[model samples]
Target: MIKILKEVFQLYIDRSDFFLEILLQHMAICGIAIVIASIIGILLGIIISEFKKTTSPVLSLVNFIYTIPSIALLGFFIPISGIGDKTAIIALAIYALLPMVRSTYTGIETIDPAVIESAKGMGSTDYQILYKIKLPLATTVILSGLRNMVVMTIALGGIASFIGAGGLGVAIYRGITTNNAALTVAGSLLIAVLALVVDLIIGTIEKFIKRKWKLN
Candidate 1:
């Protein structure tokens, strides 16, 4: 075990650039997916809240998309987008939509009725209420949803390797093809560490937001 550990350390030392490149690629794919999904999700959430009637239908559609297997989604996109980072980004974005949308909707819907009433009593318009009352009050829940999306995207982002999207997944896939256990373990470990760090950062931010808003 010590020998294996030493070898892994040496591998990192010898090929840090390769690992760094893989990490950056992974971050890029996940970042793009998160941003796209977050924007669409938050907008959809706001729309649903405004309409109320369309919330179920919209959420159901997003939920259906989430249920589709990631690999299958990739396959469906292959013909249209072809294989590469673009396809991966689309898949990851789709996968991320459900949580973000759900969280946004739930957060907004669950806001204190009294708070909204107070805002209205104060002559706040719908837009003012959303921006000042609902959004601020729901910030923590929305952040939670964002964090969940990020973690999920990072976890599944590795599967993109199967479709020629390069990242730590590529390293693990290569290891498996050649029976290189060290490479597989190293890549997997790095991914795990990355996910944990992201989760921690997001959690911290959420806590900060809650405290800042006096939502504690």
Candidate 2:
């Protein structure tokens, strides 16, 4: 174990630039996917809550999407997007939708109906009520989902290399092919660390949102 750690440390020291490049690729893939997913998911979530009749069907479909295996889903996209970061980003965005959408839906749906009613009573329009009441109250939950989506995307981004997308997974796959356990371990450790660091940052944002809303 110590020897492996030493080897990984040595690898990091010897190949810092290469590792940094791989890390950046992984971050870029995750970052882009998360942003795209956030816009679509949040919008869908808002629409789902507004159009009550569509909620059941939409939730069911999103749940079904969550069950699809990531690799299979990625492959399903290859014929269209044709393998690369674009394909991986699309797949990650789809997978990320479930969490973001569900959270957004839950966040708004769970808001106190009385507050909305009060807002309406004050001559607030539908848009005003939603923007002021629903969205503000839902920020913490939405942020929580965002946190989950970011971490999940980062973790999954490692596999993007399988589709010719450059990332840390390249190191992992190369290590596997070359019988280099240390390289595999290093790649995996870096991915895990990246996920952890991002999660922590998101978590901090969540806390700030909670405090802003005095949710606690």
Candidate 3:
């Protein structure tokens, strides 16, 4: 194990450029998917929150998709997407939806009903209430969901290699196939580092949002 570790450390020193490229690809894939999921998830959350009857069904559907294994979810998109970053994005976006939707809904729902009533008394239109009151207050909770989704998407981006999505997963799969434990460990460690960096950045953003909104 020590020998493998030394070899992997050497590999990292030798192939820093290659690993950086893979890391960028991983970030690109996760970034795009999360953006797409955020747009759709936030909309779905707003809709379901407004239309209480739809909440159960919509959440149930998103939860079902979230439960599907990442590989299997990617496979489901293969026929139409034909295996690549696009397919991976689609799968990751689907995987990200549940948390986004749930958080948005819960955040909005948990707000004091009195606040909403006061908004209406002040002649705030529904749209005004949503934008000025509900959404601003719920920002932190929705961001919490986004933070979780971002971390998970980065981890899953590694699996995209199986479908030619080209990320750190490439190294992992290559290591497995060629019996290069060093490569596998290096790839895995890079991924872990990437996830940590992203989470920290998001955590910083969350803190800023809380302070700005005076949620603390």
lDDT of residue 101 for candidate 1: 87
What's the lDDT for all of these models?
0.89, 0.91, 0.92
Candidate order (lDDT): 3, 2, 1
How well is each residue in 35-58 modelled by candidate 3, as lDDT tens digits?
A: 999999999999999999999999
Off by over 4 Å in 3: none
- Whose lDDT is higher: candidate 1's or candidate 3's? 3
Tell me the TM-score of each prediction against the true structure.
0.95, 0.97, 0.96
Clashes of 3: 0
Q: Model 2 over residues 5-45: C-alpha lDDT tens digits?
A: 99999999999999999999888888999999999999999
Better of 1 and 2 by TM-score: 2
Q: What clash pairs does model 2 have? A: none
lDDT of 1 by residue, 1-216 (tens): 677667677878999999999999999999999999999999898889889899989989998999899889988999999999999999899889999889999999998799889889999999999997888877889999999889889989888999999888988898899998788778888888899999999999998887777744
Q: Quick one: best lDDT, which candidate?
A: 3
- The better candidate by lDDT, 2 or 3, is 3
